[model samples]
Target: MTKFTLYLAMAISLIAGKVSAQDTTFELKVKLIANKIDAITKEEKEALKVEIEEVNKQLEAGTITKAQADEKKLQLAETRSKNIETRVGQAQEELKDLVKQKVDGKLKEDYRRKFSITFWDGGPKDDEGYKKYRDSINNNRSERRTTSQFVFAAGVNNLVTNKAVAGSDYRYWGSHFYEWGFTSNTRLMKNNNLLHLKCGMSVMYNNLRPTDNRYFVTNGSQTNLETAPMNLRDSRFRNVYVTAPVHLEFDFTKTQTNAEGKRLFRSHESVRFGIGGYAGFRVKSKQILKYSEDGHNVTVKEKGGFNTEDFIYGVSTYIGYGETSLYLKYDLNPLFKDNAVKQNNISLGIRFDLN
Candidate 1:
């Protein structure tokens, strides 16, 4: 079970068939302790060698100073030396028990069976037999229907006002949206992997940059984009949301018929399509403005509700083969509430599913 037990077994077995009247228990104890000390010294010294190599590599890579490396080496050497002393002490205690058992006729051939090489059993005695045994266990396993994927989607973000996207106030190139999270896909049918219900939680960041020197201003629960007094270098508004998304996915990956006549489905290998919607609550809303005031550069950060909707719902779709896909999503709720000109946030991006 433990290495020390194996060492004691070896010590006893070494002199078993050739024991002479001159071989006393004290001599046996001396031999056993000497072997254990040698083993412990070798083990600790090798470990110390590996640690010293790592420290040297770090120093060569400029990650540590010479003094730091020297200090680390000293610490590692001290640790290994202590380990040698402690392990040898433990081995001596084990040796004492073994010597007592030897005198009392308790130490027998069965004590050496833990090594596995000298003992014979009905199954898996050799390396080839053990490998086959392991393979049999692996081959009998079945695949699970539900699997998870890490989702990532990033693209341009913009606003559409009055059902018009061409003349929106936000600059399309300057605005962006990033979505990342994890999703789980479960086969809807027991026999087929054709249709799956995919659902997950995600975090999304949507940013908007006004075309002109404008920023959002809030007045009595009303938020509007208006021109700033000074010529602004940069002005952007961002909204972060935690959303739950659900999609019905069509996976056309070919199924494999194994020797057992089972259908093994490999998802995302061929063309696929997914249609879904998301609903979420906004985490936070903030605006940043940078401008020059009287020959001095200044930056301002404004955080508030800004009359923005706290609850958001959206429709999204993706189509592609394998792990990469074309993605698009549009908000059903307006960007600002109770405004004469209603604007909705929309985005198009590339999606990746790492399963």
Candidate 2:
């Protein structure tokens, strides 16, 4: 019994020593992999910082807003994470190769087989898992997709002032104006789809027709309203703008089941509204003078600044149910640049959006 016990002790000691040596080697390999991952992460972090700093500079310069910068940061972080993961995967492959080379035949085969089972189980490639992943991706894409609407608006446009100017009366029908634009609305909150931000470009035409046979003439930097020297049928001052508008819109449209039992939520279908403003530079200006010149019926188009404001800004609001709404807008800035009168623009019209 003593001899048998002595042989068992020797065998156990040999096994323990072998296990200790293999544990040390495994720990060293783990440390090496950890160091490599750290290096990759550090390099990527530095690059990300430089890119993010450039975006911050743009935000400071007012070239981009805070929201835009935040989006860029998210994109950068996602890309950086992907890059680091790829590098770590390569490091893992290198580690596996090194282990195979350094370890003895049986130990190498055992470890290599274990690593293959542990690290390369080829995660979740079954039909069920693949279907779930694909569905998740599709849902995410649908949520992020942006929708567009074509908007058309027309109404009577006139100048609003604290006090009336001497000769600045406008004929109602003749001073009619129109606006058309294409807008895209994006939901800012994932959970709350009621709030959205809308932005787009529009073309606005403001036609001002005087009460009497009068026209606009610019002298130096100031515009003067004057009567026609001769009998004039029609005279109008036209201003055009290429503007970008931004709005915070609320969509209270509710989801409903159709005849086919499919659930549908049409945008701007229920009680919906938006309050926003626009800022844009002037595109062009023209004066259409229709009068008898040299005994012949002549139409003259005068193209110039006409002392019109170059930058236009206005507050706008819309309220209604369904796709059509009553639109109201008032310009905060003056219509004319250097005029004796401080006349601002106000308009009320119907706005339609095909969403």
Candidate 3:
């Protein structure tokens, strides 16, 4: 009976020892898992602290405002919470499965915490990330460059009156003349102050005709011969001129919102006014005449008196609307010798702007 009792006591003691060892092993695994979680949490806290510091630096540098910083911080906190919760939940589930299978569970939680910490810690920093982001935004907000323009024009001139030489008893005659030429204006300045410089060349052709009975003698007192009919001659003149002009203009316009729900700006659109001057030089001149001999038409070469003057001066003014400009010019130089030539040029023309 005593041997039977001793064997039973030994069996019970052996079972108690096994139970104690299993409990101790499970407690140790739980403690190791808790330690790993604590380490991960500490690492995540440090990473978050660094991230916040960078955000503060961006705020102080004016790269971002306080409101933007706060919004970013909220988003980051939400993401972090979701990530940590997912990682912790998955780790806990894996630990529970391992524990149910009676295997070591601590390493599962440790590995999960390690992955979460790595993901958060390897994220982009505030400064470099924001620079790239802002640059992308600004690149879409710039404007295009302005294009230049070229303009061209052409016209004609006709003469009206002709004067005779005094005391020469010569007949006075005039011709209807016409000139055709082109000018190109290049835009030099574009702003509230509209400035332009132009250069051009023109070719002119003229015709002259004399009247047969348009002569009168200056003196009749010393006539030793019989009175006779006066003989007259016909003449023509042709010339070419090249000119250059410079202009400075002003625009008084204001920007406003129209009633049609469109933005409108006043411009030199109607009645643009400008003041400028021009300088021109003569290029070529020629003369042709007709003579009557024995009641027959005959062509003759005459001394086409042309001056060798090389300079011309004038002032210009404009008054017009839209694309059509009406301009007037008055020559400051005499058209003939000794400044006694009652000849000054008056030009009236139209211009267009093409840009």
Stretches off by above 4 angstroms in model 2 are 1-145, 163-168, 257-265, 293-295
Of candidates 3 and 1, the better by lDDT? 1
Residue range 1-355, candidate 2, lDDT tens digits: 2222322332243344432222423434544564665588689999999999999999999999899999999999889967965786587566544433333223343453344333324462455765566445434433453577666566667888665433448875557566766789887665455787889987787888887787887788888778889887788888988788898999886645544554443456567799999999887788888888787998989998887889999999998666556788878899887777689987766665554
TM-score of each: 0.60, 0.56, 0.35
Residue 302 displacement (Å), model 1 = 0.9
lDDT of 1: 0.74
Which pairs in model 3 have colliding backbones? none
In candidate 1 the C-alpha lDDT for residue 284 amounts to 80
Taking the candidates one at a time, how many backbone clashes does each contain? 0, 0, 0
TM-score of 1: 0.60
Indicate the worst ten consecutive residues by lDDT in candidate 3: 141-150
Quote model 3's TM-score: 0.35
lDDT by candidate, in order shown: 0.74, 0.69, 0.43
lDDT of 3 by residue, 55-100 (tens): 8899999999999999887777666655654564455454444344
Model 1 stretches with alpha carbons more than 4 Å out: 1-142, 294-296
Give the per-residue Cα lDDT of candidate 2 at 240: 80
